[model samples]
Target: MAITSANQLELLQTAEAVAREKMIDPDLVVQAMEESLARAAKSRYGAEMDIRVSIDRKTGRATFTRVRTVVEDDMVENHLAELTVAQARDYLENPEVGAEIIDEVPPVEMGRIAAQSAKQVILQKVREAERDRQYEEFKDRAGTIINGVVKREEYGNVIVDVGRGEGILRRNEKIGRESYRPNDRIRCYIKDVRREVRGPQIFLSRTDPQFMAELFKMEVPEIYDGIIDIKAVARDPGSRAKIAVISYDGSIDPVGACVGMRGSRVQAVVNELQGEKIDIIPWNDDAPTFLVNALQPAEVSKVVLDEEAERIEVVVPDEQLSLAIGRRGQNVRLASQLTGLDIDILTEAEESERRQKEFAARTSLFMEALDLDEFFAQLLVSEGFTNLEEVAYVEVDELLVIDGVDEDTAGELQARARDYLEAANKKALEEARELGVEDSLVAFDGLTPQMVLALAKDGVKTLEDFATCADWELAGGWTTENGERKKDDGVLEPFDVSLEEAQNLVMTARIMLGWVDPTELEAEAEEEAAEESSEDATEETEA
Candidate 1:
């Protein structure tokens, strides 16, 4: 409809209706209508003129005006919108340089094309306002479950009609066996709410581990109240899942609370998950204890934890080995995920056999490398001497403390070890030089002669080459050799330097070459200090 004084009330009513339908403030809609009228007035008043429109909130009367800002003659840029103070004085008395002079203009009759243009502008504004409203409503709602109806399926992805806006549930985020039809009510975790050019796109997920955790929080009051905490959750989607819980209160039992009265609480979660098995285990601070709890139903006889490697060797009865491994290693895999440890399952008989093999191998290694007799080699093995390097590095007093080894024999053993290492290093040094290793790299503290040879063979011969190497590259990682990358089957030759040692060696080389400025380190330290201060302030506010 054309905008005129007679229909101005109708325009206000239309804005109110649009705002009500879009769930936006009416003031925003009225402002949008005013802008649309201003754009249409520009077509009649010449586009170069600055036209504006305002509508009375109570009377719904529209006013059209042309605005000009007074400026000095030298400061005026656009002649249509800016007038010099001398020229503005003719219209108003004593006009200041910053004064705004507005002249009332007769309202123009809206043509058909002008009405179309105005409609387009109003719709665009309404759509933008709706997007902003949706973004504000859903942005902070991420990680919470929202119930929606399945609106339609687009290429196997379900578009859900959430109350305020639509959300997309990708096929991969849905459970393996679950399917939905149009109008089917579903609940999903808000994985992300991202603002796009078209609108805000909400992504939903039902298979996320946090989704299960949120479900438990909804069903269990203790979890919602903070008395019990869900420490970790691992899910197999439609098959099985496990969650670890701990109680802050000494008297409260977290597992029993999560289980509810006669498994009613857990059963609710299970039903929501489409009958997926749920194991709500109690969390433990100790690593071994946690692993034992994570690998439930299959008793673990013993657990050998290698903390540095983040691995656990679990020994179970022979009959329980298959059970501990589960169908296709699912049980142990889930346990590993739950406890954040790499689990190696072993039966009692297998552990014993492996122990015997390792003992014999160590004995053989000592006897061959140290040139010791069988009895002496066996004695060294019993004393926990595995390799020639250990014997070479140990203190003479430690060797003396061993049975049948007096001071003289200890001294002799030490001398032999030193001589063997020196001879081997000398041989490696010659080999490194033959491979064209630079003197600077060979002089670096952490790069042994063997490491030097390895670097030279890989074309990393100079100090600059070593400086450019990352710690993972200098330490241990997969390397492509002979047209193939190294596999994890224990046949690759890993670098000998540790990550810390490699970093030190690289920094030392860079410092020697003056490649790094000391001021950069100072700036980095200051940045870290500032970050820590900010984090402390945030934590204090939260507390």
Candidate 2:
């Protein structure tokens, strides 16, 4: 085809048609047409020449031109595309080193092969523009719910036509028993929107916990209006789930609001979730209290929480134990997820047995370490004396508070406890030195003799080694691997070193070695305090 007056307006019509069909900007299609024409012109003109084409938006007239840049004589690598500054007088009055000289040229008569190549270039550019438009439209819709019509299923994954673009519902993200046919209306959560090489992918999910929360928000007026907030959600996908909600308005009960009249609101969510059961519980700031509510229908006898470890123990009646754990541990597992804590459920009898075992163990430790009889050790353990260090350093008045203990007896007990601790510390120091522990590490404050021996055994002998250690490495931490939490043994954890104490000890060692500057730390602390104060003032003003 040739560029003629009869087909001058055809380019704009084609661009607009392509843009409207693809839901993209018309200017992008026009630019793509221009580049395709330029590429075809380059094939007809000398390949070494810089042939450019521009299409008029108003008239659709295509203009072809060849450009040669004026350059220094030594920089003229391509004579067809570049002109030396001294040899450019024919086209310019004064050609500078970086000036461009342009001349009009006739458009190329695109042959069959050239027209096909131009068509491919235009299609590629249009496809890229379509992808960009799709990504832009859906990226902010992530974490939201969308309603779409199922287009088809490929390899167990359902593809839905989400209005302007297509979204994918992977097999694992579908409710286990839920299946869809072509053209079926479906609702799903927009789990993520990703830009891939092929196109922008919209990932939809029905198994996400947030999907349930969004369903409640849609079904319940109180949640939609922010009178009640969904604090947490845990789903077992097509089986069961737990949702924690808190009401800002005291007159409204969060759980009752979520349940609605005759369980209307929650039932709507459950129906959408393929008949999955939902337990709507009132939210509490206190973790143990919240956990108790999460594990509903099973009364708790006692609750023991380890805040640092994010662990909880729930003691229930023997009969309620089975109910608390549910079928195959689903109840407690969902409760653990809802509370963000690891849970251990024990029956009352089991808890009592465990307590008795702990008491006997502590009594035995006191009996052997303090050289006391079982009766004396039992008294000490009953009075909350768990270790020899507490007995050795405790005030005589505290020992006197125990039964049948006079001032002389307290004195003798303290003397014996101190003598045993001293002997143990001396032996630990000897063993640590034998393991190549340096005096600098031993002299560091906050670390006991036993802690030093532990570090030495773990190959952290020198002060530098101690300074380089991570806080978690010295405090024993938990790690999640493949959805299960595993415990990482810390070298000094047996000595009861908390993470904060470990960090402080390491920082002190670093300061002594001049590896870190104290002034910079102080400056950072001051900056953080200032930022916190500013934020508090802003919040107070808003309140």
lDDT by residue for model 1 (382-452), tens: 88876677788898778887889998888777778778878878998898788878798888876667677
Taking all chains together, the TM-score of candidate 1 against the true structure is: 0.88
Single out the weakest 10-residue window by summed lDDT for candidate 2: 490-499
State which candidate has the highest lDDT. Answer: 2
Off by over 4 Å in 1: 1-5, 71-79, 84-86, 93-99, 301-315, 346-357, 477-496, 517-543
- CA displacement after TM-score superposition, residue 305 of candidate 1 (Å): 4.5
Q: How well does model 2 score by local distance difference test?
A: 0.93
Prediction 2 TM-score vs. true: 0.94
- Per-candidate total of colliding backbone pairs: 0, 0
What is candidate 2's lDDT per residue for 1-543, written digit by digit as tens?
898898989999999999999999999999999999999999998789999999999999999999999999899999999989888988899889899999999978999998999999999999999999999999999999999999999999999999999999999999996789999999999999999999999999999999999999999999999999999999999999999999999999999989999999889998999999999999999998999999997899999998878899999999999899999999999999999999999999998998899999999988888788999999998999888889888988999999999999998888888999999999999999999999999998888899899889889999999999999999988999999988888888888788898889888889999999999999999999999999999999999
